[model samples]
Target: MKIPGLSFSLKRAVGITSAKQKIARATGIPTTKQGLERKIGGAILNAVIGRKRKK
Candidate 1:
């Protein structure tokens, strides 16, 4: 399955969310969905792309 611009495994997606949450926690950033997306969208996209290319 595909999610528009994102192409990666569910496990990988979960990892991204976990990493982002960690960053948010360390930096005192809000963990809200929109806030996370705004702060780490590029990192999440890059991670997925890099993982996909490896497989």
Candidate 2:
């Protein structure tokens, strides 16, 4: 149940986001949904479009 003026997050209380961020930074990977989607989408687009090669 949620009450007005009351906001609580168990993940935030346990520092899950900070831990995930640290892991992502150490591995050079994304730990968030949007970030992962963006990375994958960019890769797909590049594959479809192809990169220009030097002459």
TM-score between model 1 and native: 0.33
lDDT of 1 by residue, 1-55 (tens): 6579967678566697788678878987767878767557656776878753222
lDDT for each residue of candidate 2 in 1-55, tens digit (9 for 90 to 100): 7799999889989999789989999997898889899778877877888973333
Which portions of model 2 miss their true places by more than 4 Å? 1-6, 52-55
Q: Which regions of candidate 1 deviate over 4 angstroms?
A: 1-14, 31-55
Cα-based TM-score, every candidate: 0.33, 0.64
**Candidate 1 RMSD to the real structure:** 15.6
Q: Quick one: best TM-score, which candidate?
A: 2
